[model samples]
Each structure stands twice: as structure tokens, then as C-alpha cells.
Target: MTNLRIRAVEAGDLIPVDLPAPRPDVDGARWRRTRVAVADGQIVGIASVALSAATDSYFCEVEVVPGHRRRGIGTQLYAAVHRLTDPRFPVLARAMDSFPLRRRFAEALGCSVVTRCPAPWIDPPTPAAESWATGQQAPAGYRTTVIGDRPLAIVKDAWASSFAWVHRAFGAVHIDRIPQMWDQYSKGVDPAASAVAVDRNQTIVAFSLVSPDAWDGRTFIVAETAHPDQAHGTQVLGATVATSVTVLARRGTRRVQLEGHTTDRHTPDVMRSLPAVGSDPMDILRLEPPPAVSRGGCR
Candidate 1:
């Protein structure tokens, strides 16, 4: 503990520490502040806190290197991030359930689960499995196309509108933050494997966002969404997922992950309709404000 030092760093200066790089390309990434715990000139723990206009909350991420756990390093890193968080808005931390230590740390801070989701890994459709979705079609008057055919702005709006309910604790996503959010979520995405459903007016009403999992090249993440106003959203979503997953399997992706939260009505149904192997569940924890204290005065 004597040689431990915690200092601020720019996005470029971040040492991986096995955490996702909050790349600076996001438009609002400049507002994100990072801190690292260094001992003997080597980074062993990292923490970052950023205000997202899209979610209207302070988002935080913290990680300590394997050999450095059980020390107060994680607590110190988290303290740095909490100090940087704006108290006006709630703070949300995403800790994978697979890591009980991380989750326990968040719980110790009075954080409670806001949402629970199980991301399932499904085997790429074989010839027999392919037949079911292979013939699926978009809703009447809607045509299927690659997501790249549409402008990102349009896609962003459609995506936020459909998925905003899952993040209700944080509020709706602002239009300006879309680019940064997309850059973060769509890394290594397969353009051909991502599909969209456009109505006759050339408006995108539904989409399937497909990207290779960052940790596993053979595994892909598949996210599907459709506008709630669309009377046939279910059909559109099914068709889009069918189209995207087929192309992903054809491209040699071995496993596809379908993310579904208990709060989402559409995605859970869509995921259940598919042939999935197993799931990895996780929870999003939101820090609750401490109870106000009363002051006593001499009368």
C-alpha cells in the first residue's frame, strides 16, 4: 500500500486491465474521466465515470487486475470514480453476475438491481434448424435490407425508441449521443449480417444489429428491435433476426448470443422462439442515494 498511487489518465493512456476500452471516438467521451491505481509503476486497477446525455445518468466501470484482488485497490479505484460522479443524477454500474466479487462490491455501495438480462448463446443454425427461419418474411409492405443502407441517425432514433424502456431508470437516450453509443456497441460488426426492415416509405421500422463478440471471434452478438408503434413489430423483428442470423452462420460464426432482459417484452419472446443452448445472466445495478440525516440544535 505504501507505493500505491492513483492518478487521472486520458482514454489513450488506459492500460487494458482486461476492461473494455472506453474509446475516445464517442462524441461525449471527452466528458468521461478515468483513474488508475499504479503500484511500482504498473497499473493494477482502473475506474472511469462518465455522464451520458443519452441515458441521463452517470455510468461507472471499475476493474482490478487478478493478482491485485482482496487488497483495497478496487475500493480506492471506485472511490475515485464516485468522487467524480455528479450527484444530481443517479449512478449506474454494470457488473457481470459471473463475477460475484464485482457484484458484491456494487451491492456494498447500496446499489440495487434495476434490470436483469440473460444473454443466451445459440449454436449457428444447421440445415435442419435453418429451414424454420430461412423462409421467414418481413411484414406486409415491408422489405428487408442491410442496416448500412440507412443513415445512422435514422437507425439511432429507431433503436432508442424501441429499447428505451429497458433503461427507464436512466431515462431516454438523447439523439446527440447516438454516434458514440453506436461506435461503442457496434465494434467489429458484420455489415452484411445486420439487417433492417423498411416500410414502403423507406423508413426503418425494425432492425437486427449483429457484431462479433469482442472476447470471442467465433461468437456473435445479435440484437433485434422494432418500433412499438408498428402494428406488426413482432413479425418485423422475427424476420430481421432470421435474416441476420442466417448470414452470420453462413459467414462461419459458430455461436450467436441473443440479449434479452426481463423488462423487454419483445426480445424475450424473440429469444424464446430461437434454438438456444444456454445463457449467461447479468444485472445492472443502480446506486441509491444515502438517507438524509437530521441535525440537532440547542434550543
Candidate 2:
């Protein structure tokens, strides 16, 4: 590497190279900030982090041009990012099955696999409003509607509270449970893209939320939760998918996506209810800086 330099950059700098947008999960301000490793004015790799005061950990993405590997660019880029994000926040990223080098690098940096499996994805073809339907009967006193039709705070509260009870035995990160982070997420996509089921008392009992897929403008399910009382919550989920697809399609949305963890109890029901085009086999890796590097955050 000649004259290799790692420096902070704006969102625009990353656009040309096609890095995925920072996770919509954040608090206070957006954290799509990028630090790039460049050699002789050519970008070699980019390292970025998701920041939110409300969450216990962070999510990060790093990309080093395949040809630029074995030269230490990624290590420097990662170190640069930790300086900006509090090193105390644990960071996670997906390691694709085809990219063993990325897995090795992430592992070398103290990351370990956390997801039960590569997340599952579903992209149902957008159907006409008249064609979309979920036949299950709504639980007594429960009614489903577009999330925006309800009060924002009620929806937000339900969104925040669901994190604790949904999958009791299986531990996982719930980024949207934090209101401020949810603030960042909700701002990025239409609230109509979300659906919620409310009980007779008007308390939200089940819900599903979607946002624009960061890599593309298509819809992606950012969060979902269902009350345990109703058919393992599938009816609500089914209604949610049906509502989202019909509404979004009316607005010209051609497709919708949802991701599931392998161990999640709802995975099977979700798969059976909707059609899936394919899945990206992925491993979620958790990362923390080394003691020496952690002392100063992201130096």
C-alpha cells in the first residue's frame, strides 16, 4: 500500500461505491458516517457504524476491496470507526457464506457468531388490493389496521415493550425497542408500510413494521411482534403481510421482504404463510475492540 490513509467521509463519498445504507436503527442523529481507507486517491475499503444512545450495542459494516486485502487496510478502517463510535458498544455484521475472508477478519477482531443462522428472507409478489387476504379470524376483541391510523405514542410504546416478552427463551437484539432508535427507523419509510392489531381496549397486541431496504428502495420488515395468545401470533403476522403488500402495491411497491432467525419460534409459520424467492445464508458476528484499542473508543 502506498500512501495509505484512512479518513472520515460524508454519506456522498460512499454512494459511488455502493455500500449499504447505515441501519435505520438509531437514536438522536443518523450514523451513516463513513471512514474510508484510500491509497493514492483510490478507495480501498469503507468502515461504518450505527449509533443510538438507547441501545446496548452497535451494528457495523466494513468493506475492503478484494484486491486490497492482505495489506492491513481493513484493520485500520475498523480502528478508525471505533474512534467515532464508543468502543464499549458491541458491533455486529453479517458474514456471507461466500466470504470466508470477511469471517476470518471479523473473528480476528474478537467477533463471534450470535445469530441462530443466516437470517431468512421473504419477498412476496405484490398482489392487487382485492387479491391480498389472510383468512384467519382475528382473536376476540382484536382488530388489525395500518399502524399509522393509531396514535404514534401507542404504537411506539407497543414497539418498545414487545422486546421483553416475544421470544422469552431465545435472546436477541431488539434495536427498535428503544424509542429514539425507533425514531430514526420510522423516519426512513412510510408508516402505512406497518400494520398493527389492537385489542378491545385499544392496546396494541400484535404488530409488524417495514422500512425501505437499505441496499435498495424495496420494502423490508424492520420489526414485528405478536401477542402469544393468537395462534402463535401467525394470524396477526399474516394480516400484517397482507396489509403491507396490498397497501404498498397500490402505491407502486412491487415487492416486500422479511427476515427471520433460524431458532425463532415464528420462522416456520412465516415461511408457510408467504412465498420466498431465496435466502442469503448469513452468520451474524459480534465484535468488540481489543483492550488496548478499546481504551480510547475509536482512535
Which candidate leads the pack in TM-score?
Answer: 1
Model 2 poorest 10 in a row by lDDT? 290-299
What tens-digit string does per-residue lDDT give for candidate 2 at 256-287? Answer: 55655544455447655554545455677666
lDDT, candidate 1, 1-299, per-residue tens: 77999887654564754755543423344367777888887778888877776677877777888888778787778776777666777777776655777677776556767777777666665763376467667878988777665444456666666556555534665656655666666656666668878889887777777767655443545455544456676677778878877776676576677765666556777776776666667777776443310121111
Best by lDDT: 1
lDDT of each: 0.67, 0.60
Clash pairs, model 2 backbone: 26-181, 82-298, 83-298, 83-299
Off by over 4 Å in 2: 9-34, 41-43, 65-67, 83-88, 96-110, 116-132, 148-154, 164-177, 226-232, 249-252, 260-264, 288-299
Q: Give the TM-score of candidate 2.
A: 0.71
